[model samples]
Target: MPPQLVLASGGGWGAAPKMENGQPVPGEFVVPNGVPVGSVAYFQVGNPNPSYVITTVTWDGGTDIKGYMSGTPTSAPAKKQEVLTGVAKNQTSYTFVVKAEAKNYTVRADVQYANGAKGWVTVEFASVRPTTTLAVPEDKVGFQATGDTNTHNVAGLVQAIFFQATATTHQHGGSFIFMQLVKSARVESAYFENNKLVKEYIENDRSIPNGEDFDGKLHDDFLNRLAYLHIYDGNIMYGWHLMPGRSMPVPAAPPGGTPDPPMMFDDPKSQVPLDWIGNAFTSSFSTYLMYKPQSGVWVALNQIDWSVSQAATRTGPGGTWEALTLPAPTQVSQPSTPNGMAAFPTWVNFTSNFINDQLNPWRPLD
Candidate 1:
């Protein structure tokens, strides 16, 4: 077989690598996650024949593209087409600094063997959207949320009920919120006795805050619109920085009672207790600002379903969790709604309407 081409990494964007018939292959060239402008795309040369040597590499077919090798400039700055030819030795990898545009970019390489055989391989990196950096909000708790709604049936139902409501008060939507309120929140690689975490080392900490909230008009649209769902799944909270020396807010110890010991990694055999998973770890709330549209008379419906799981890692936030010993669905009160409803009725309150209002000003429903 000839030398194979595969993507080593995708600037944390739309790069997918898969296997074909038990062999590695780059499948589905379309980048679904989207490569933002000014992000790097890394590709690898896999399983090359010992005799085959890469003579030249080229990148083209995008609004702006640049080529780099081992962190060194290989092409003339930013150009429509970039070519790096006459490589001194074998290149195991190549890099491309890409710009967001509407078109696709193609990466090609020319290979030659000592025995006079020549071959070439081409891989296309496509799709680009304007870049938006979400400065993860730092908080005592590790929870960031976003919500959306649909209210097409409100108009007809209001005529039957003979009542009026705000343009957004009658909409139906849901918000997914989860908090790592416990200290030393970590996801285990496997399950163990007494539902303990098997892994000891913390791969990543959600306590550290980094990055910035959406600054430009492009990012503003992303917060309220484009990447709303993406943020929920992107685990934006991992980059959040907590207060100095504090991972999360610990509850007050009972009178004359000692606080729980800090989670330790020195002992591998010591099973870490599940107390690290705090209450209301993750919630999928189906809310009705004004529900019962079929009856013409609408009432607030804020039903929030909560669960906890071992899969709740620092890198990935929203997903179905396990019950373990706790009840499958714990009943918890709904916080202030977007419309200022306290305990189901409030005359004045508007600030704490969003689940993530503490971290971000952009509400998903707005």
Candidate 2:
């Protein structure tokens, strides 16, 4: 007699049955249709007839199986036989596809059964996202020159005292003011001729041919005008002498050593008379003034009055040692000279002309 075929629930094939006449009966076998990446599947089959003893069960394709059973069919519902169990390979969602050809697979119960039955399984896959970050650079600081108090003397001259600046940190733009004290002298009195005889002697002397010898008030007015104009600018200050070469440890004379005073020339033949002259006396002092538009504040940095002398001089009355207070910015337009000399401001023309010619070439260093 021919053996009967049985089928399993999961995925498995039953034993091959004998041929009744010329055709062999079909048996149960389970196969996988499709499967997703990173997953497993199983199949099984069972036998019903008790007369037949299953010897072997095989699948068409070489698929991996977990477990199997082979024995004579004693029970009505005999244990199911497993054909194959397979595990799908790892792949991305876009790479996974369904095809007719048998690829990777898995099975659970492996055995031959008396009854014909079959089954299959499938799975799916997905894709992942990527990771990332960002970075930036740092910022820098800046600096510039603003003002000084000693450039008036160099007015109209080719090389004169100038306001110099350097960029210590960054780049910027603005203007600076340089101030100075220029000392000029005139004949005050050659010989004290107040009496009749003295006046007659002075009149007879051709060298003393002058009207109003020299007035102390005139000299006072000249110095006072210079001082007042500087103070009014708010960008300048008073200094006794010009600082030469911007030199360090400025030369000084010994105490009370009869330091050489500035020379005075009184040649009657010369067109310009009463020249107060001396290279040692020619010097400039410097102080810095800065205006910050953002903060609206005018800052005064280091202020130094450079002078050259054998020794420090005393602050005597009616001397250049006197300090003058600066006028308010509002009062700068029209300034009044304390001592009476020329009613007009002389230093203004001096500074304006100097800036136009000599100091125009002055630029900040890198």
Candidate 3:
């Protein structure tokens, strides 16, 4: 009788492993009919007659972090054994089971017979990459543009802020002014991000819960990074932030000090002056801003006007950040809110919006 080595029970006709509604069934073995024609979690190899009672099976874990092979099984519900050698050779089919991680495998399996003849097979577990849901960036259900009209999405936000009641309307500085400036700022360049990176970012962030995918949230949220642009008019500036889909955090008192240009370059953190941006009591130079998510608060990194001199250490302790250029920002009185945060019409939101104009000796104002 001819010795045989073939996949026995994968995603085939006879038997199949359990499956979740939308999820692919795990542990699919190989089958003779050749549909999938490959093995996933398990395989079988036996002699046509008694001459070759497939004795042992060995495999390389490959991408799998770790795995183990159990004793041979001739019947249903194969019992776990320390080694395949102890199993009876008279059985018709010898089954080798493998449990792996990450779904894709390039395992190489070797089979040995009682007669010492050896044969091996290489198989791959090509399964679909699982898709998951993510949190939505926009509040479609309860976000109102003003007091009456409801709004969502970027375009809606642009229009809302564009026509939004002037600075004092929201009882704060002009969100509209900043909005208009950004619109005219000329998108010198923007951050490049894809859904994958955004998804990874969302997943890594504890604040963001697991949800759905392929929707607009991932794309929208990433756009909120607000760190991608270089603008110029009379001054050379590099800035970022649209302020469309983000929370409002009270900006810190504008950075107040003298304009010692050399002072800002002292600390690597302060090397690029936030005061130069918009971190000012009032300013004719670049404005700078920072965001701290842990406390859910935004801080104006360096608060300074042109009159104030540059010191050092602009950005507070946190993660990476970005910036954008803005015209001189006017301060508005914050309302008497219980939480001291967002009580005023602050020009900058709680974002890592950085602006580099005269401050950046590297890219000085044009």
Candidate 4:
């Protein structure tokens, strides 16, 4: 009978090569295709026969990996892969590096017993290429994150770029007063396995104080807004960054806080609405102030009427529409209402009466 084969190398994960369909075949290992071009995968095989010699190891997809970059490998590798004719079977293995065009591959090693018997072992591994629709460089294959709530998710497919990403503006509508206003925020983006975010990505991005998001936007105007969840001292904190290393005005509880409820940005409340996304339109309301707070309300109300008359007209799908109730402003502005927007609430207290009653109410996903 052939001797047993054992694996003892790092960077490899798979069942030992076994008899499949009555032939020696290596077990399969799955790896993301979105990996660094030169990333190395290592594997070793142990021979049960103490008196045997490994003859050869061959990698099919590695003909050009040897000296493609940085010149040739300096000395013989500690692990034997090629030219193993006289090498002891116990102390040898094979290693291969990823290339730009890598794909499914297998390695085979030939061995000979002291008594002139011949046998062989085979191992296999696979590469799961990135989604070509959102292709990213292989080297950028690490956990990445981006989003705040007023914007979109930031991501990269080509660079380890250090670009500015900001959300720091709260003009009128939205209730993220404390969440906006991040200046000089730098973010790096890379592809992770899938949308399934893990603690590794969270903690890694948080430590750097910079990162990117889904659409590949890495500029100072990076505006992907996502309800953020963080990890601190082994606790998951649900909240957003007002700036670098700070929390949003009204932060959320961490994981396990509500038994079985997933974070807002992750599950049921994942789809944030556009109308509910941006800050309120407060131009008319600001102009109302010129009429005095008491008159400001009336002036603002009237301005709506005037605007309704001149513009901002729309026809519903069912051929329905509503007329402007208040008069349009003659000199200044008014506060935003269900019909029109004029002013920005000085601050946002999402749970306060002002927000729930007067200011934009459809905000801060529950």
Candidate 5:
């Protein structure tokens, strides 16, 4: 009786998990039927029929396929193909490593049974590279209070300071920026909130609830060690209330100093620096932003003017505020990643201080 060939272990069938940076990324084992380029997939074959003894196995691939018979699967294959002979009489199984280098690959295995009976099987899969979609950097434009051609505006503020807004008009106020990456059937959406990460999803695995943080745990493998956001030629401010008549509580006059003047809602001097956001204040104004998403650590080029609005309010300071960047809207560049990870230009991490050009040093500029 002839032996029936079957997959013994590892990623079976069409999915070939590749070795990335000498390591296997999680969720690669479950990818339906495709392989990411520059990755290696291991396949073990078993002989179901005891009557036939598996003696030798040979692997062949297309020009771009790097195939191996022995060694670690965590690294790329050294050569194009491999052949192994002398499989002790009744060897149960044999494993082969194949690296995807191009768009398509057809890996064929010629199995030699101890009886000299020859049989072969071929597995075809595609090598796909993930596409990264990054939002273009633009100027944060326009500010409209309630009943002024805008929605409630709270969500806008939240969108600005946290999530990546889909529309260009909604891009303001965000604390972090990101790009969506899709590879094969997997769609990865990751970001940082409060400089911390929470969850990640793989290949239509959308179990994570909405309005939740999507921080990819495999960020280091895809992005550079450092990323930067450039804020230049504009202004940013924070205030207590979004309404017309907001004011902060005034203390009594000092021993010899008169009490500070009241902060009028319309006064340009009414606002303060961005430190009003609490603990994140120092980190926010400095070159080093308080974020480290799985993608990478982020730095900033803060050339914007900063101010804060008065503390007093008509409604309890409920994340509401009257703030604006005017005359010239604050222009912000998108967060940067390595060219190898995504298609992006080299980012210059320096800023002009009106005196000269300087690489925004890694310290607080507030």
Candidate 6:
């Protein structure tokens, strides 16, 4: 009888063996008539006759399969056959083609079967890209100093006077003038005269003699004088002088002696020659006399503190001194005063030693 083949319990079929003398036969078996890409295939072999030796069951082109099976069945034509399992090596040679869109990729897998059959399948995956963002620019702010306006060309002189005043008795108090220069604005120059804004005149003529009096002239000329002197002159000085009433007595004759013969006021010979004598009186007195003389003899006096000159020294019981004490109310207090009213007291306060310390060389009495 020919060897009978039967379907296996494991969803596979077994091949009929060639038989002789009613004995079992052996043959090779192949599995998976067709293998899909990414799919696994399995198979089994059986030997019944003890003398029927089982040889190798080889698989061809099973490289793409993911798993394997092998076993020798104990009973011939049994209902169930046990399969020995093995792993299929990954098929590196199998090519998987992929198509990509903006955010995803599609992969098609083609598989070659052991029996020269091939299969294909497709799968999808995701893709991504990178991203970024940035920022903007901004503006700036600040200030600048512009000096006096009255004297358009004497900023340096103004500064010098300011420093001098500050160094002396002028308190650290005064107004400041300034302006803002916007982006890229150039500063041509700045003139500072008593906190007034003047045209910038950095390089023009800047000479200002100490006592070169200014008459009622051009406003610019008056301002130039003020700038050079750092002291208000002209009408400003007039008001300033009047503010402090005269304190010194007119020069007189010696006790019970005759007064010096009056010289014609207009006579150059009769008029007392003006001089820059030093230490003639107390600073206040000298200052008043220096600018507002009463007679040939210098006398102590006062003013509204616009500016004044005075004796180089005043004698005290201790010794001859060389400093001047500025009066209080250093600045002008009001715009007007009663007619004939003195800004300060009328009586002059001279110590007993005042007469002996006179530094003037040509005192009328002397």
Residue pair clashes in candidate 1: 135-212, 135-213, 208-240, 208-241, 209-240, 209-241
lDDT minimum window of 10 residues, candidate 1: 155-164
Candidate scoring better on lDDT of 2 and 6: 2
lDDT of 6 by residue, 1-366 (tens): 111122211112122333457663333222212111111223322233334333322223222212211111111111111212233323322222111111332323343444444433322323211110000001101011223232211111111101111001011111111000001101122223465433221111111233221111111111212111122211112111111221111134567442221110000000011221112211111011111111111111221122222222223222333334211112221112111112111221111111112311121211
Q: Compared to the true structure, candidate 2 yields what TM-score?
A: 0.17
Please state every model's RMSD to the true fold in angstroms. 25.6, 43.2, 25.0, 25.8, 22.9, 49.3
Q: lDDT of each prediction vs. the true structure?
A: 0.28, 0.21, 0.24, 0.25, 0.28, 0.19
Candidate 1: tens digits of C-alpha lDDT, residues 1-366: 345666545544434443468664632244544443334556665546556655544433332223221111111111111222333223556664443233566655555555666655555555333211111122311221112111211111111000001121111111111111111112233333365443322211222133322221111111222111121122332111122122221234566443321210000011222333211122222212222111111123222212222222221212223323321222223322322121121111111111232333321111
Predicted structure 5: lDDT: 0.28
Runs off by more than 4 Å, candidate 2? 1-163, 168-175, 180-286, 308-366
lDDT of 2 at 114: 39
In candidate 3, stretches whose alpha carbon ends up further than 4 angstroms from where it belongs are: 1-40, 61-104, 140-366
TM-scores, in order shown?
0.26, 0.17, 0.22, 0.26, 0.27, 0.13
Question: Which model scores highest in TM-score?
Answer: 5
Relative to the true structure, candidate 4 reaches a TM of 0.26
If ranked by TM-score, best first, what sequence of candidates would result? 5, 4, 1, 3, 2, 6
Residue 170, model 3: lDDT of 14
Which 10 consecutive positions of candidate 3 have the poorest summed lDDT? 260-269
Model 6 TM-score relative to the real fold: 0.13
Global lDDT of model 1: 0.28
Off by over 4 Å in 6: 1-320, 324-331, 335-366
